[model samples]
Target: MALPERNNEGFLENAWQWDKATAEVIAAESGISLTDDHWEIIGLLREFYKQHEMSPPSNRLFVKAVKEILGEDKGNSIYLMQLFPGTPAKTACRIAGLPRPTNCL
Candidate 1:
């Protein structure tokens, strides 16, 4: 299937075009092979976007949101960093086919 258009930074131009296949392609570009753990966060991010219509604006907020939902065991920076290297929120939102976090750089 043809992939959806993305911005220069690799985020989907239209989040509505996202799907599992699209996510796999995007994640592969980052050398990530999605596991159940990855899917857990991805699912959360998708639901978050559905509910809030935006991604967490920064890594700290992202961690806090995760901690609120999944608790500290899986929500800490170290764990998220291991699952998604380099600015976890940015990398994760990209892979989740969500818009870039407004304050992430």
Candidate 2:
């Protein structure tokens, strides 16, 4: 399928255009396989965007938010980093089809 327009970093230009197929393509580009674990976090990020209309804004906030919702076992940096290498929040938001986190790099 023809994916929607994306930014230089591969985040969807319009989040409303996102879907599972689009996420799969983007995750493949990032070398991610999107297991259930990944889906759990992606769902959280999507819901967060739906409610707050923005990404977590930084890795710290991402971790904190996850901890708040999913608890420490899933929310810690090590766990998140394992799922999304480099900057966790940035990579995750990109794959989740949300706008880039404001304080992420």
Candidate 3:
């Protein structure tokens, strides 16, 4: 099943309201600058809308994604980690602006 399209304006009025501290934690752990470039994959994942109806495997996928987008010769996990640390899944998902993950339990 697909996730309901969130195209409605103001639908996010109560979505992922990250405070300054939470945003900072996500940034510090993920190292991904909370910028447009960092948001590309998140957008892509949002569109993915897996059968499970949730965000994709973020931390695990970040490495492979970097390699695919930036080039396999250049997308190393250690480096990506420096850029997006923690579980990578957490960092990626949060930055992607998706909901917090479930398996993160």
* Decoy 1 TM-score against native: 0.97
For model 2, give the 10-residue run with minimal summed lDDT. Answer: 21-30
Question: Could you give the candidate ranking by lDDT, starting with the highest?
Answer: 1, 2, 3
Better of 1 and 3 by lDDT: 1
User: How would you encode candidate 1's per-residue C-alpha lDDT over 7-102 as one tens digit per residue?
Assistant: 999999998899999988888989999999999999999999999999999999999999999999999999999999999999999999999999
Clashes of each: 0, 0, 5
lDDT of 2: 0.94
The TM-scores of all predictions, comma-separated, are 0.97, 0.98, 0.46
Ranking the candidates on TM-score from highest down gives 2, 1, 3
Candidate 1 — worst ten consecutive residues by lDDT sum?
A: 1-10
Residue pairs in clash, model 1: none
Give candidate 2 misplaced runs (Cα > 4 Å). Answer: none
Q: Write the per-residue lDDT of candidate 3 for residues 1-105, one digit (tens) a residue.
A: 222233232112222453434444545544445655445545544554343456655555545656676676535666555545656555565654456555653
Please list the residue runs of candidate 1 whose C-alpha ends up more than 4 Å from where it truly belongs after superposition: none
